[model samples]
Target: MPDDLREGRIVIVGASLAGLRAAETLREEGFTGSLTVIGDEPHPPYDRPPLSKQVLLGRMAADSAALPMRRDPDAEWRLGVRATGLDPVGKQVLLADGESVTYDRLLIATGTRARPWPNADEAALDGVFTLRTRDDAGRLTKRLAAGPRRVLVIGGGFTGSEIASACRERGIEVTLAERGPGPLVGALGGTLSMLAAGLQRAHGVDLRCGVTVTALRGNGRFTGADLSDGSRIDADVCVVAMGAVRNTEWLAEAGLAAGPRGVACDAGCRAFNMYGIVTDDVFVAGDAARFPHPLFEYQMLSLEHWGNAVTQAEVAAHNMVSPEPARRPHLAVPVFWSSQFGLNIKSVGVPTFSDQVVIAQGSLDERRLVAVYGYRGRITAAVTVDMAKWLEYYQGLIETAAPFPPGPGAADGRPLVAAFPVPSNVPDPKGLFHGPTVALTGHLPDRRLTVVRPAD
Candidate 1:
């Protein structure tokens, strides 16, 4: 290993889960470098998953969701200060407060922010909200406690759906509008999405599919919303759960392969320059990184899962201090879970990346089953509704690239063979109102390699 990799200045550009985990792993791996963590938020790293679930439901406090540190990394913390720019050649990160930090190695894990409502004026209304940070969750929690007459959620993604579920749990009338045919269509595809729609509707959610919120009606406070179908909804609160926008604007002129999607990187976590050249000193991880995965035919995957952040950060930290021969690839199978409408939905691998899906265990009619996804006869992904126990088994099949339409014996005691597979019906990325939690951005497994940029 190089001496500089062991003892040198290291700066992490995000103080969130990925950055914190990377710093801890670096110290654990014997990297005695001068470490610094930069964050835009005023508080230390906190758990975001609960912000939409327990926090909004009043089961947990927003401020109490701080992530407990495994060990002190003994690094300088720059909280509430944003990194304004990056000078890759100069090896310095320019901050918002006219400060710069030089580093021998840099970890870019700035992550993403909630995409704001398109109209700035309408978004500023009293009841308009978007949940991403602790402050956002705290404000929304207070608002929900006040018992608004009706809550209108603009997008039917996971966050939006969860918000609606919370509203329903509070006995508040909630209307969810989705531009697609059903909820979760962008991530789980059309088949499972149908089940999601049914669940939402069955649970007292006024689920409106194939409709867009054309305008928000308000007078200092939100009153209602105009829909595309020439109908107006009277709601006192509105949540724009459109999705997230990658935090890569600061690196726009840095010449890195960064854009709206995310910063491009190799499977080894090395960031790529604008010319597509890999740089050794700089690495990327978490939701802000798009890296290729060999298991998915080397397609560059952009993941926003909590597990991905921890595993990828560890891999990046290991590679940052280890020699090329000892560096390992970040090949962890993508996994995600959601709780809504009294159903525990979990998925392994990229469900949208598959072309066909089969019900492996339980029946969809029962609303408690595992749906296995495949592409060209290869098991690619699996999704379960209240059937999380088999997630690990399906994950192994995906990791091994097991044959799709898996054997009949894999099911429970029931002798159920692989059912006839149906089209997954994944939507086009451009048409999606919300970003997918797991996105396969590179070429298809059967297709040749191609460079896919955010613009393309």
Candidate 2:
């Protein structure tokens, strides 16, 4: 190992969960380098998951969700200043404040921001909001506390569903609209999404599926919304949960493979140049990185899971300091969890990457079950609804590439039978209205490709 690798200037953009963890990991790996973390936000890194759940419900203060530092990296922080551009060849990051920071190694953990509503005028309405930052949560918390007559949520993804759930928990009337068949259909399959729709409606949520909010009809403040189905919803508040946009616009001319999908990277978390060539100095992690996963047929996965941020950051940090022979791949299976409508939905692996799903344990009618997803007869992912105890078992199955429909006598003590398998309902990326928390990007492996070719 070269001593220089562990003792050089390492600049990390996007002082976020991934960035913070990477800084800590670098220090833990004996990297005595000069570390600098730049964040556009004025506040320190905070936990975003709670912003939609506990914080919005008033169970926890929005500002109190600040992420606890495991150990100080002893690095300089450029808070409230955005990274304007990247000079890869020059090894420098241009800041919005007209300053440039030079670095030997750069970590692009810029992450993603909430996608704003397309209509600028309507989005600027007084009661309209989007949840992504700490301040956004705090402002929405105040609005929720005011007890609006009704809350209209524009999208039915996880964030929208959670927001609707929080509104309902506050005993506030909430209407959720989804362009798809149901909530979470883009991530979990149609079968589970049907269950999700039922769950939301059962809990008094105005679940409006297969419809989109065509326009927000508001003057100075939010007054109502017009749906595609020719129905008008009268609500005082409107939340645009249309998903997130990766923070890669600043890297547009940086000669990196970055765009709407995210910055392309390798399994070791090394970033790729514009020509698809891997660069040694520049690396990326978190929701901003698209990396290939062998378990999912080597498809590039762009994940927004908290677990991925921490694990991938550590892997990136380790690889940045270690020699090539000792480098390890960031092959950890993706995991995501959401609490809405009194159900704890947790998924192991990429459910959207699979083609078929089967209810292995319990029943969907009972709302306590483990659904396993498979691709080519192999288990690829599992989603547990109020059955999280079996999450570890399913995770192991995914890690080992266990056969679909699984065998009997597993953790739950239920006979694993191949129930009717249904299409996973993974939507086309082009038509999607929201970005999924776990996205299987890039080309899927060709199942028919063989090593030997028949002579034509």
Candidate 3:
């Protein structure tokens, strides 16, 4: 490795969890380069998972969620400045403030933003909220603390489910609307989705599935909404938890394989140009990266999990400094967790990549079990509800490509559930309102494609 490569200028866009971690890793890896971290938010990088959990429950202040730095990266912090353009040929990042920062290597860590309500007029309503950034959490937290009559949460994803759980914990009236058959179906498949729906309803949540909000009713402030089923919800507050939009629009003309999905990259975290040629200088990590994994049939994965961001960032950073022969692949299995409705939910691998699921251990009726998901006949994913302790074991099985309907000794002589291998019931993303935590990219086997025939 050349000393010049080690001491060259490295710029990271998006001063987020991924960016901060990558910066720290670079310095730790003996890189004495001039580093610059850029962010659009005025505040420095902070933990976002808490925004939907402890911050909303009043267990912690929104402003107090700043991430603890492992060690100072000694980088130049360019806060509150948005990167408007990228010149790959010149290795320069154009800023919105008429400034351009040149870099020997660039890292794209621009994560995602909350998908707003479709209706701009209704979204501008005073009582409406979308939780993403610290400011968003603070504003929504204040609104939640005001003791509204009733709160309506649109979407049934993890964020929406957590918001509803918080409202219920506060003894507030809350209605949850999910356009899918049940909450979390798009992410965890049907077997667990049913359990999630039951959990929400049992906890006093006015759960409404298979329905969409047709209109948000308000003159100047959000008052209520009308559902597609011709039902009216008169609530004091409305929360749009529809999902997230990747921060890739700004890179449309950057000559990279960047789009609504994300920037396409290889397993080693090297970004691919629009022509599918991998670039050595440009890299991507966090929610903005769509990298291929060998386990899931080489399908590109877009993971929005915190663990992925940290691990992938470390890999990207290490590769940034290491020579070609010493570089490593970012092959860590996707993992995510959520605490809602008094239940700790954890998932491993890509559940949406599976076709069948089996109750390998515990019982759904007991609300404590591990659901193992399989594609064809091999283990692809596993989800545990209140059985997170066994997650590591399942993760090992997935890594080994263990056969579905895991054989004896899989659960330490504990009898597997009678409801063995069943359809995973993973639905189409377009049909669901909530965005999935781990999105399996490339051509999905379940999605229908119309064949256009030329005139004979």
Candidate 4:
């Protein structure tokens, strides 16, 4: 006999956007069980995309940007309480208050947080921060309000680039340092990042590419940073947008498969233990779950995008209360977007997985076009800047596993160029993951086999 959906104790950890969505879906699926949500944050889940843009630009209040609930979930909201530990044998979650909540079924959506500067003495410096939570935005926003003389932003990824864009929009002087060759090389590619460098320079940004911030110097508060190219900038503030670290440390002894990458999960969102054995009652989602994807040779992907969180959460919730026959798979294409350097960049598929890329539409000269990436002889990813209307077309190509290096016809008669530049992997600023941020790492595919989407 299958478990009854009407009455099983369900506990959700992390209280993030994904956690909230799962709670709502559980109730919608007619699960009337005792439900409780545990979180380290004091407030409800809020939208995070705006933190780098609107919040920094003084356009939106940190609290006001929170996502509105579709309906009252009615679950016991354990706000501000952090989960200290997890005991799979007892099926209980240990809270900071020394309270334990037992559950027949559990969902882990812990997600990730910005990885701060490694040195404690350096991280403790004033005006140095990382953006992840609403509270983080609030503090940074207030600091930006003070109108610091100069801002030194480290890392040139989406978050860091967006912060620079906000500064430029505010007429604030900023110096951006990237360990990679250019701004978005870690995510997009060095080829496209060249254009990004151009955008920044056009807007009068002190964009320093292919250089690193070796050390942050300050007496007690942040005053300046030393660059790898033998240069120094005396700035009043510094923001470390060096990427994120998965928040799965508490699950170490929980007997689950958690590691530096993220928790390993199957297509149906069922969590795997340290030995790779799938669990029946435990599930995982969001940036903390590394599930395999067909587009990237089925290697597990750990994504920090907003769409992945919502989509993966729904899949986990549905599978939680449904029979095996009724369970669905999470096969959503990995996509992400960012607004920086006065350009709206949207990407579908994993660009870092490709060995070659071509400007399929618009024109690189104009800085408005879609670039298609290919691995071996198949389409792997697509990136668009300003010209986003054509992304849907290329997205269809990826969804259908279309041919590699999509023809100039993909341009839809925009214009033809002789050739375009392909990109190479550029590691993070901290030199943690030497691979590209959107890495193409995976098992070598059998050349004889064609790419196929996995079954649910």
| Strongest candidate by lDDT | 3
Q: Could you give me the TM-score of model 3 versus the true structure?
A: 0.96
lDDT of each: 0.89, 0.88, 0.91, 0.82
Can you list the residue pairs that collide in candidate 1? none
Put down candidate 3 lDDT per residue, 76-160, tens digits, no spaces.
9999999999999888999999999999999999999999999899999999999899999999999989999999999999999
Query: What's the true lDDT of residue 84 in model 3?
Result: 95
Report the C-alpha displacement of residue 350, candidate 3, in angstroms: 0.8
Q: Write the per-residue lDDT of candidate 1 for residues 351-395, one digit (tens) a residue.
A: 988899988888767999899999888888999999999999999
TM-score of each: 0.96, 0.95, 0.96, 0.94
lDDT of 1 at 270: 93
Candidate 2 Cα errors over 4 Å, as ranges = 1-3, 416-418, 444-456
- Least accurate 10 contiguous residues by lDDT in model 3: 446-455
Task: Give the count of colliding residue pairs in each prediction.
Answer: 0, 0, 0, 0
lDDT of 4 by residue, 1-456 (tens): 126865688899988889999999888888888989998998888888998999989998988887788777779989899888899998999988999999899999998888888888998999898888888999998998899999988877888889989998988899988776788877777668788888888987898877778889999989999988999989988989888888989888999989767888888899988777889999998988888776667777778878899999999999999989999888898888999867899999988777778777767689888888887777878899897887788778888778776665665865445365454453443452122455433442332344475321
- Model 3 score (lDDT): 0.91
Which pairs of residues collide in candidate 3? none
List runs of model 3 lying over 4 Å from the truth. 1-3, 443-456
